[model samples]
Target chain A: MTLTHEPSGSTAVTSPPVVRRRRALTPTRVLAGMVRVAVAVLIIGAALFPLAWMAIAGFKSKQEVVRTPFQFFPEVWRLENYRTILDDPAFVRTLAITGLGAVLFTLLSLTVNSFAAYAFARLDFHFKRALWVVVISTMFIPGMTILLTSFIVVTKLHMLDTLAVLILPGAAAAVHVFFIRQFYLNIPRSLEEAAMIDGCGKFEIFVKLFVPLSKPPFVVVGITSFLVFWNAYVWPVMTITSPDLYQVQQYLATFRSERSSELAMLMAGSTLAAAPVIVLFLIFQRQIIANIKMAGLK
Target chain B: MSTTVTSPPRSADGTPLRAHPPRDDRIAFLMLAPVLILLSIFVIVPTIYAIYLSFFNWSFYQDSEFVGLRNFTNALTDPEFRAAIRRGVLFVLMTLPIQLLLSFLIASFVTGVGKRLGTALKISVYIPTIISAVITSITFALIYEYSGGLLNAVVGLVGIEDQAWIGDVRLALPAIAVPAIWMGLGLMTLIMIAAMLDVPESFYEAAELEGANWWQRTLYITIPQMKNVLLYLLITGFVAAIQQYELPLVMTGGGPLDSTTLPNLFIFNHFRGDTYQGYSIAAALLLFLVLGAISALIFRVLSSEKLVD
Candidate 1:
């Protein structure tokens, strides 16, 4: 009754993920499909309820948001809230700072990670063994454990309250180096070899042969890093004191805490903060999802 | 794949194509120096400094006094520290199982349907994960409002009285955990769906031919085949849930008689301008060791354990 051997022996060499369909339309089969579709609707509903509720509440009038009987949709939509928030200079600045830091972090980390990953993936050096241990071992060392001391370290270096504290401390993450390195290893060496035979230097070879060929991983990791920076809360809270310097998540937290009673304001701010990441996720979702599934397959 | 990527470095069969002349070694060093120097300054130095600070009564203001293990001893006996550890464990207990079960059931259905519908379900379930937890908590806060909230509104239809979710001590922890659990569902479900879809349909066909009912077929085939993925998710979930800082910090503020004061918040309470900063560093180090041991044990099990049905 073992299936490990039976599956490989099947005559049908179907493509992946081909669920065997019931050939005849039995009543039980129809019922099962109906039940599954019903569950899908429910699962999607539960997953999206809170976010949809927030967006809906953002459009409600001040008095209508907390009305005793809940209205699923606002009676009179308040589009002015979005307009006012967008017109506010301070709010615009917060979005700008958040975007600036996220873009900087993504770009800087990609270079640092690709360089280090390239070294490990393609180079041979004297201390390659010991150096790799030095790099990768730090992956297990929890960032929380080092938070207090890292704060002290950054403060001594005079990085507190600056964008450097946000961008640089996270720039050379061991995990990214490892992830990109794993991707780098999968690429065929022949391309690089051909470039090498063309009398191209190592840097030239990497630029020509590797960078152009490695767009997918860069996109995947770049998007991931950007969202991570955008969503960062704890470190920015600890390091930055100025309201002007607050990142997107920090701004959302401050908005809700200082104005917890104003349901409309909080929802509007939360929705705004969630907007960019949401848009980005929708845009690159195909690649992101394919990467996630590929991660599982690996 | 392991998120930590702690697999040992490969044997020197690595660089056969590229010749490693002295000039190449210099180039390699130049490329690696950024990662190496940053690691030393940030990660390596801080880890060593944390251990160093655990011995001394370090403070931002006054001269730090050297006390031999007094901080550790104080943290060990501290009631708040014990409760924080327990709450951290409580989060893992409350969230991981329910998320796994929900993911399993949801994935089974999603993968069963047509492909386009399945993709739509996956995207809807996963969209929330991309949003920041701080925003998610705010969204949850409105939903968990004492009056006119969605939860209360729904329950009122069932003739149940409205509940103070984050305001009540008994409900605060679970309330704080809900948004976090919800945020995690997309990733877990996506991972689960991938794993479930990977299981060969022929196996189920064989079981059906053997007269195995749907439930029995799942038990004998699907569950056993998905064990490694399940275990992987469990370990990652444990690690992730225990680090639950943002949700509780945002939703409940660790309030209602400190009912939701998680371990990280507990550490923050001490380290952020408290006189007991030394004790906080020590406690953090202690938690690190415990988590480190657990992670190591997981790696051991992952590498060595044979699959059995």
Candidate 2:
């Protein structure tokens, strides 16, 4: 039944084990093991050191940041640097706007995306297959290509400089739709079939049955969309001309230019911008990896 | 379909339908309407409009004029646009193979090790991928700073002189590339690891029985099995490199004399400038076409009947 042939059990029994075991400990094997350990260290170090440096730099004083011998940790750890960023009214406004936008985008995107996913996965409809393909194909279209024209659309709708500009356009992502649909497809038909026989309508089945069953995929989509909106820079930068409407990432980008000499301040802003998503990743690392794997398989 | 809709057969209770197929279609359509409409307005319309704008003399102040193919011609001849495209291609060439190779190697190594160690390494590697691109850029910018930069501080311990990593004209692209590769390595590694794990244990066991060494098993058994995932990464990673904007925008500002000006940045610059909007739109569309063609070509080349598959 398997697609590829497996080595027969007789071959495993007949193989010379002791000779091969001795051969495996040759100098090349030892050298290879050493190389592997070295590479592992290098990989882990490369991944971790920049993050560690950023965290340490966030606490260092401006003087200590650029001082000779390059202070790895602050000589005098300053909480004031983070305080400076946190106290700024503009930073507060940016965080509020970004947070609200992310929440709205997540709620809206998850609701709509899951509805469409359930429809595509469970319900029979005209052009269901064709429409699903269309949705999936849009996932391949690069965001940058249509960005300018989309900005124009937003402006025409008078959404420019409004949080709606951020939330509405991103409210229906193809990737989330595809991810949720894949999850929905795996749910057994028997559950929905049984529900239908109990006099539940499609919408009822969707709300009571589908929604209750697919919480993990929904959370993955919610977190993903939230992260995108929270971390969004290019769209907000293009559309948000009003200083009051700046998102955190845009605010931080500008903050870097305005105070380029203040390394500690900049790192503090980076930490603020990066922390929540990092925490989210930590909590849902397994689900995030699964989501990515799902994306790849498509 | 029309027969079912127009004059449905009566059910046992003399109802028009039993399961209500037409009603189900209607409900499905209702469920699908929001996303479908939003996608149309945001994605489909803008795509068509971008193509339309490519053929016009249009901007905020300028009067609209339909000048077919002129914008495309101008983009082709524009030196700055050409340089941007060349730099983008260079970035892709420089980063993709390095990231893919490193990620694949790390993934293989991580899988070969014990489970707890593998999980620890995976978590550490994957941490950066979740961080925003802007934050990563700023972090690296500080790290790339010449005088008190972390990289220089480390290298100086070994007596290497401090060099302006992002400030130097030749080094800026690669400097930007360092963070780009680092940010992506985690996700790539994870994807590769997942793909590697999909190579069935039986294949490895069988290969071991035949006296195949580790390298041989990887080459003959693992890689061949992971071709689709590898190709998937190849195309998507290539497309991502083509659209790169945020890292270079924040880190180098496409700087040290435009060494890292990706095509997306070029388009953004043109969009900001009043006169060059047409050229930007035209180039953006062209870049889209080029990306599509390249992805298709990759799919075609790698999708030829593999000996094992």
Candidate 3:
């Protein structure tokens, strides 16, 4: 159906193939292309400039950073800045804590949310529609509204100032459930039917059949959950008081607040903190883009 | 729903039909149980507790005293709270429109270019969105530092007296907004550009045949087609901008006369303070109600028009 419409529409509209092809190469077209190039460059430049500058400043001495009207490159590189940040026990501890938090939260969220999505997509049960709506409604509740109550709960449970609290509350994200459910709905039902005919139980079908075929969405959920949990600042900062339990973002904030004058160390810490996510993005660029498209589609 | 049973067709084995109830009900509930339990304990339960706590003057170290509606009354009447609301509204007003317009312009320009270039541009724009807000705040802090800062050096070159960008009470909020706007610009641009690209090519082709210039094509075919996406962006942007906490927290700490104290920061300070325990909880509750109401109103308006669909 798609191909039929394209060729038919093209043929019906144009018989002047040579003239039209020539028009495509006209001065107007060339000017248009050049303008597009310029615009692209400007857009790209705006996005990358700050990040590039941040990375460069990380390697520059404190004096070099503010010495002038922003020199693009530092005269003398200071690798010691990175070493100093790395050598700090607190810095290393926070990094481990953040990684641990991100990994634990990601795993827990994936299991719980993916299962919930499976139910929403494939099941017919009492209050199914109402339950789905209720879950989705939670997404509209701004995180700020629940901060106080969550704090009370955490304190009441006596789980405050621990990494467990950080990881546990985030395990029940409504948005992740919604995203995965929408993705599950898009999967064809034929696979499920085939599995059922082979005498596979519903749970087994989900694990052996649905789960195997759902790599893309799982990756999307995993990556996004990892990012959100890793970048979490306000929650971890509020709940975890000990420097030992502080996540990377919280640690960075503390570093900035305490060493306001140490620009090089701060920048180096920031660079190290952001490196893992950047590496993940670089490796899974296509999956990330596809995931974004999937999100927007819903 | 009705269940019907039919006899199995006789095969060589002559197997009888098996009437098994749909397994989906059991499986669905099973799948959803863990998530529901977690959410109930962490999110839903906390929310209910927060509402309960808001009505009282409950401190961490003292006996709980119930003073119904007093905290809400105080929050409404307090000048600082009111000022925070005003500043938040102003910040939203300043940031959302400018960011949206800039992002849309950038996105539209990139989409008009070819796919390869457009993809590269989109990635560059999206990179900043991925960088932690802490990094952006620090970067801007360096840029806005009063003495020997990049901004000061630039002002010096222009023969203007160097002014403190973030330290000045009057300029602190706006200075904070610069980084917020910059951090958000790329993601907003990518989304807008994606929406613009979703417009059917036939619309542009038709406009071209009618001798519509580039501007006309963009206005008629592009803008109109992206109305839904624009509305989504506007509402989401408004909500996000109002709740802005990271930049102001990291860079200004709502300092220099409370110029940059957003509602979230106010709530954070209250919750973080050891003395104001119950009052902080109360304040957070009040803030949540106001924000929730605003969000609901926006969502209602947008959904009423079916903008999301």
Best by TM-score: 1
What DockQ values do the models have? 0.47, 0.37, 0.36
Q: For each candidate, what is the lDDT? A: 0.79, 0.79, 0.74
Q: Is candidate 1 or candidate 2 better by DockQ?
A: 1
Structure candidate 1, residue pairs in collision: none
Pairs clashing in candidate 3?
Answer: none
lDDT of 2: 0.79
Candidate 3 regions with alpha-carbon error over 4 angstroms: A1-35, A68-72, A293-298, B1-22, B277-283, B293-309
Question: All candidates' TM-scores?
Answer: 0.91, 0.88, 0.88
Worst 10 residues of 3 chain B by lDDT: B9-18
Worst 10 residues of 2 chain B by lDDT: B300-309
How many clashing residue pairs appear in each of the predictions shown?
Answer: 0, 0, 0
* Model 2 residue B43 lDDT score: 89
Count: clashes, candidate 3: 0
Pairs clashing in candidate 2? none
Tell me the tens digit of each residue's lDDT in model 1 across B26-53. 8898888888888888899999999998
Error of 1 at A201 (Å): 2.1
Q: Poorest 10 consecutive residues of model 1 chain A by lDDT?
A: A1-10
Candidate 3, A138: how far from true, in Å?
1.9
Better of 2 and 3 by lDDT: 2
